[model samples]
Each structure stands twice: as C-alpha cells, then as structure tokens.
Target: MAIQRRGFIAAVGTGGAVGLAGCTGLGDDTGDSDNTGPEISGETLTLTTTTSTYDTGLLDELNAPFEDRYGVTVVTVAQGTGAALETARNGDSDVVMVHARSLEDEFMEDGFGVNRRDLMFNDFVIVGNSDDPAGVGGEEDIEAALTAIADAESEFVSRGDNSGTHTKELELWDAAGLTIEEFGEWYIDGGGGMGEILNQASMQEAYTLADRGTYLDMQDEIDLEIHVEGPVKDGPDELMNTYGIVAVNPAVHEHVNYDLAMAYIGYITSVEGQDIIESYTSAGEQLFFAEALSEDPEFQQYVPEGWGSSTDDE
Candidate 1:
C-alpha cells in the first residue's frame, strides 16, 4: 500500500528511501451485528518494524490493501530489530514486524507479545566492491569468507545498530571463530539502518552483510556487489533470513490497540496477503517468499522456531 499523509508519519531514519503514508480518515462504520471480533474502524495501529521492510518499499505495497479493507491507519516506526522489539515491549507499539528470532523469542517469553506468525522470508548476503579485496568472492562458506576478510584486515562495515542484519553478522563472525571485539581498524561499526549501512559500505568500498532485498533495491544507487551469496543464491543456510509479525500483548499493555493489531496480523497472513508478498519485487527480482500459506506449516509457525515439546515441558 502506498503510505498516505493523512495521519501517517514515521519516526525518521529508514535512510530516506521512501516517504511515509497513512490513511486520511478513520472508519467508524460498524460491520454486521453477528461479527464476533473487535471493531477496527477509527483505530490507528502502531507498527514497529525493521528498516529493511520500510527501506525496500514493501510496506507500501503490503499495507495499502489492509488499510483500505479495515478503514484504519497504520503508523510505522522503522528501526533496528532490537529497537523495534523494545518499542513493543515498552507499550509504544501495537504490533511488530521483525526478522531477529532470538530477540523475538525473548519478547514472547517475557509476555510482551503474542500471536507470532511466520510472515515472509529472504536471505542475507555478504556484499563488497567488485575487486573483492578480501578475496572472498565465489565462496559458499560464509564463515570462511568472513575469516579471510578479517585475516586480510580489510575494511568491513557493521550495522552495529542491533538490527537483524547486525545479529546475523555477529552470528557469522562467531561461526568463523573470530570475536569481533578482537578485530582492529578494519572493522567499522555503522550505527544505522540497512539502507544507511549499505550506502556507507558503498561509499567506502567495505564489506558488509545485508539482506538480499535491501541490497537489490538499492543496487543502482550503490557501487557494492554481492561477494558471497546466501541461500537465495544457493549458498549456505546460515544466511537464511525470515521475518515475523506479532501483536503487543494487551495483558502487558492494555492501552495498546489490540483489536486493530490482530486485524492487521490476520490481514497480512491471509491468502490475499501472502499473494501480495509473493508478487512484490525490486530490481526485477522477488524480494520475499511468503510462508503463511504453506500446506505443511511447522508448529513453530505459531511459536518460536526453536520451540518444541521440551520447551513446553519447561
């Protein structure tokens, strides 16, 4: 959905990629008397989400139909994944859409969120200049490529803002047996969103880990190239990136718009929603794969991916 200016504004810092949009007027019409759920009309749903979604312009296409269907406005605050979850935990948001699972699990276990759903997915890629200064090009092994980059003392840009991409970058470093704390000047911490970090990497010709969608969306604006591929390009699974949507727990924050939040969630996970996600593309490439309509979904689709019988026993 194209973001509208009527009551729509974003907390700035998604790299100025797209302007914010919101619905103009609230919907006060009550549906049929037999409807069992809360009325979402005339409500404003506050959604805290990762910058990747905002930066790639997916929200414009994804949220428009939902807003029209419900006659509600969606106010988005795009930030790093960690910051997004924190916003929900603090009762500042009605819902969240983020990609960092570990952080999401903590939010759920702490009773700040509920109704988690596997929404959509893409993959992470290691990008750098075409020269491939660290000699990491064509390597399927993400860890090895990272190690080589470190060993060569090459410039590496980090989203150090605690975003999902930052979390994945740290995971890759750990897998490579390299503590980022030990690295020298070659490591650059870019405390910004995905689009900003990509721009930073582009200007400096440094290496950075980024979601495939954001990279492709800004490909024309930046000089950086994909030095190593993620699962989307037949690389390792460690680079697989999945995003989730969860509503803030009304039990934790009664002021939150729980009804409208659930409505938004239901709309995004429905068959029509899945199709919208599937059809969204950038740079002539599909950005995310819809996961909600799978015929054989996992139990974790409704919980954390690592949850199982043992977690339940505990």
Candidate 2:
C-alpha cells in the first residue's frame, strides 16, 4: 500500500519538492483522443532514464500505474545520464528523464528535446567501509571529505560511466582541488551502474558517491556504511541532486512520437504523478521527493494551484 501524497511531504521533509515505448513517428502509434476508443491498447512509449531511478526499481513502480492507466507499454532503457541523453540524441528513444542538469541543458540546446520539466530530486551520499580508513566519516563538508580521501590515498571507486553521479563526483573532486589521475592507484573506475559499483566498492572497501535511494535499497546486501551523509535537512547543499524529464524534439527527429511523449511529460509532472513519487517507499522510507510541486520558477508553471513562479507558463 502507498502513503497519502500530501502527508508524504509533511512527514518525510524531502528537501521540498519535486515513458514511452514506441518507435513510430508522431501520432503513428499512441493515438490522439479522437481515436481513443478502439485503438488504445498495446501502444509503446520508450523511456530513457538514469541509473539512480532504475537501480532502485523506482522506474518500475512509477511507471506501472501510468502504463496500466494508458494501456501503453513502456520499454525502459536505463543507463548513466550521459548515455541516456545520447540515446535520445540519436532519436532512439521518445523521452528522457535524467539527473545531470548541465547535460540536460546541452541536450535541449542541441535540439534533442523540448518541454523539459523538473521532475523530482534525491541527494547523493558517500558510502564506504566502516573502518574509516580515509577518516571521512561524518564529515560535514563534502569538499574536505574528498580532500581527505585523496590525501590519504584511500581506495575510492568511481562509476566512471559519465553518469550524473559520476558528473557530481567529478565536480566534487574539482571543488576539492584534486583530480582522480593524481590519486593514482587509490582511485578505481568501476565503469558500471550504481548497484554494480556499490557492490564492487563494498568488496574492495572503497569510497563512492551514490544516490541515497539506491544506496538504501541495496544496503541490506552490502556491508558499506553511509560514511558522509547527513539527514536530508542538513545534508551538504552541493550534494543536492535534481532530476528532470524532456520530450524528444519531433522537429529534430521526425520519426519521434511527439504527442504521446508530451502526454508522458504532462503525466509525470501532474499532481497525480508527483504524488505517486511521494507515496512510493520500501521498508517504510520514501525513495524520492516531489520537487516539481514546489514554488520554483522552473516548476511553477506545472504546479496546479498557480502557487509558484512560472518561467514559461509551465
């Protein structure tokens, strides 16, 4: 059973809040309202999203209701944020939902997508062996923690998949005035998804940056500890991870399903969809927060009550 969506916000304090499966051209498959009666079944919408959501099974939970409601099958192609965007750029997917903000911007400017919408958010956490070899445990300053890890030449694992987590890891290294190359053998690139890298890090006892949701979901099977994460309310500001969705531009890729893709964008950003995100949990812990419903300029247009500032009336 799911929790009540409104109460989820007050109860969890999630920093605030906030598919498609088709391969056809716009309106070629998932039909419009006019043809809704007889042709509503078995339409496909291909969704390309990130490891953070995919690894934790949030994608399945989130899409199940949406897929059943529309009678549309959603084929999820999961990878690091960079790869997911690349899949959309090549016009292989109908829509994208990923974390890396700068890459999302580049994707839009390069004419890959439109109707980009802020979806949801969950911060990253630094996980490591409980031994505290790097002495980074409980470090309030993420930069300092990273610097300490480098200075000690402690074993550190990187997703190295150009993922949003990897992107954030690189940014943290930059902020720490260090580089992975300089760390030499102490730093290892796992070149895999969150769960794989986390498992590798656990076996090797290395430090790594992981989305909190994924870490929590996989924690039972691993021995790693949350070495450097604070409570959501007090977590490092720089660690905040925001996820967004975009409808692949039909103009750039003429064979894309623009209409159904937009419906997906609309569905996930709507109150019901955001609520679905808020209500989802495992072991009684909510995996994500609904930032789309917040009063931010980027998301205001999508908020139902006209409560926030709308940048494009969305």
Candidate 3:
C-alpha cells in the first residue's frame, strides 16, 4: 500500500489552465462521462525554497522519493528565505518551502497561499573556533553569550544575505540587547549561502550562526564547535525552526497547477512524508526531527511537543 501510494504521488503533474471552466470539469457537458477528465500530462511544478535546505542537500533527499512516486518533475529554485517568499508572492513558483514564519504568515494572510503546514525542524547552533575565545561554550543563555562575544571583540561571521539563518542571527542580537552596529570589525557579513558562510567563518576563525543540519554536514571541514544551542540559539521564543510548504493560490495565479500543487503539499504533510523526514540523517545524526501534523500543544507553542524543557535535546 505504501509503495502504491508513493507511485501515485510521484506521477502527479501540474500546468497552467487555458480556462478553469474547460479544465476543471465545470464546463463539461458529457452526461455519461465521469467528471474527472484525462490525467494531466507533461506538467512541471516550480518550487522556490530556501538555500539552507538545498545547501545541506536535504531537499534532494526529500524530493527524490516524492518524484519517484509521483512521476512529476520538480524544478527547485533555491534562494534565501526572503527571496523565496518574494518569489512566491510574485507568482514565480507553484509552491514554497521556507522557514520564516512571520513573513510566511503575512504572505498567507495576503492570500498568496492557501495554507501553511508545519514541516520538519532543525535548530540553529552557534559555531565558533575551537579556541572558544569568547568563552560562550556550554552557555544556554543566548543574550549573555552574545554579550561575551561582543565584550571580547570576538570575530563573528554573519549571513547578511537576508536568509532565514541571517534573520535568526539578527533576532539573537536583538535579544542580546547589544547594538552590533557599534562592533564593526568584530562582525563579518558573508553575503552568500550557508556553505559559503561556513567556509568564510572557518577561514576567519569567526563565530557564526548555522542550522544544525548544515553544521553537521560540514563538520569535518570546519574547526568550529557548537557554542550556543536551543533557545539561546534563537532566544526563548521557543527558538524552534519550523518549515512550511505552502501551495500558491491558483486564484491569484492562473498558471499555477493547483491540483498537483495541493497534492504535493498533502503528501509532504502526511504521515509518510514525516516518516521520510525522520529517516534522513548525517553521520548518524538526524538531519531533521519530524513534527506531527496534529494540533499538539508544543507545535502550537512553537516547540516540538515532548522535546523536553531543557535547552538541549537528547
């Protein structure tokens, strides 16, 4: 049953309609024929998503199973979360997978997407040189950690590209209540992807914020150690990293394949999808922890339910 379901999902395709009336069976006059018309063919779905997931190679793993099951070709355009959201808003993609919740909410509220389902999650971690010059290691308080770094004039690399990681970094600084604007040279902005930023931080021996998945994937090449994690990584606001897959509203964009887009969304949020997410790991470490689609309290509160109240996950 699972294999058959997977096959059904992989064959789904999407395309723009000449008119909904002619394609959606609303205008069909055949009384003897089923309302469902011929299967959609040769349709392509464009997905605009975050670079972190792409850089970490998570999307490829997640999408491969779906593609094999659905027989549909998915074209992924990877960019920063901000750019991804903007692309979805501009109707350039049929679906969006991003991590910026507030921005995503605004997009949905504006009617660009029909629904946003909570996907998998991986927390951010503060990585720095092994020397630990800032003495931020094992620190659970993010604000104090940053303050120490600022006071020590420790080198800090930032993903200034408006990516989700960058957004989280800025929020951390804000929570620390330190004006990073005054600490000029100590801060470095790598206007590139997470991989590039990691390389830059390594080259400079600077501290930087990174998703756990990317850090784990590149751990061998990096001399940095996980300094701050959990709430301190993004502050006490749960600091949970939540990803959402949203279907571009067909009502707003005539070219979007609403049926196939929704189908993909449905598959991704289903139990099978969560199982796939849970199965991916790097060096024996889970890449992303699965989040149930149920209205669990922890999910509702931005923390994965049963994730424990501690700052670090076991």
**Pick by TM-score: which candidate is best?**
1
Which model, 2 or 3, shows the larger lDDT? 2
Runs of candidate 3 exceeding 4 Å displacement: 1-38, 231-238, 295-314
Q: Each candidate's TM vs. the true structure?
A: 0.88, 0.83, 0.80
Ranking by lDDT: 1, 2, 3
Model 1 lDDT tens row, 31-82: 5566554566667889999999999999998788777766789998999999
lDDT string for model 3 (1-314, tens) is 01111111221132212222122432233454666653434467788988777877777877776666556778999998888988888889998998877677677768888656677677787889999999999886778888999999999998898778888788878887887678878898788888888989998999998888888888988887888776423443335566777788889998887766766676676556666677777888777766534443234322223335465554
Better of 2 and 3 by TM-score: 2
Report the alpha-carbon TM-score of model 2 versus the true structure: 0.83
Task: After superposing candidate 1 on the true structure, give the runs of residues whose Cα lies further than 4 Å from its correct spot.
Answer: 1-37, 311-314
Q: Extract clashing residue pairs from model 3.
A: 9-70, 10-69, 10-70, 10-71, 11-70, 11-71
lDDT of 2 by residue, 1-314 (tens): 12222222233332232232232222325445554323434678899998778878887877887677667888899999999999999999999999888788778767787877777877888999999898987888999999888889889999999889999899999988886776798899899999999999999988889988898888899989888874464668788878888889889998876666776776676666777787778778878988655443454322222334376476
List where candidate 2 sits over 4 angstroms from the true fold: 1-41, 230-233, 295-314
- Answer with 1 or 3, whichever has the higher TM-score: 1
Say what the RMSD of model 1 is.
Answer: 8.7
Error at 108, model 3, angstroms: 1.6
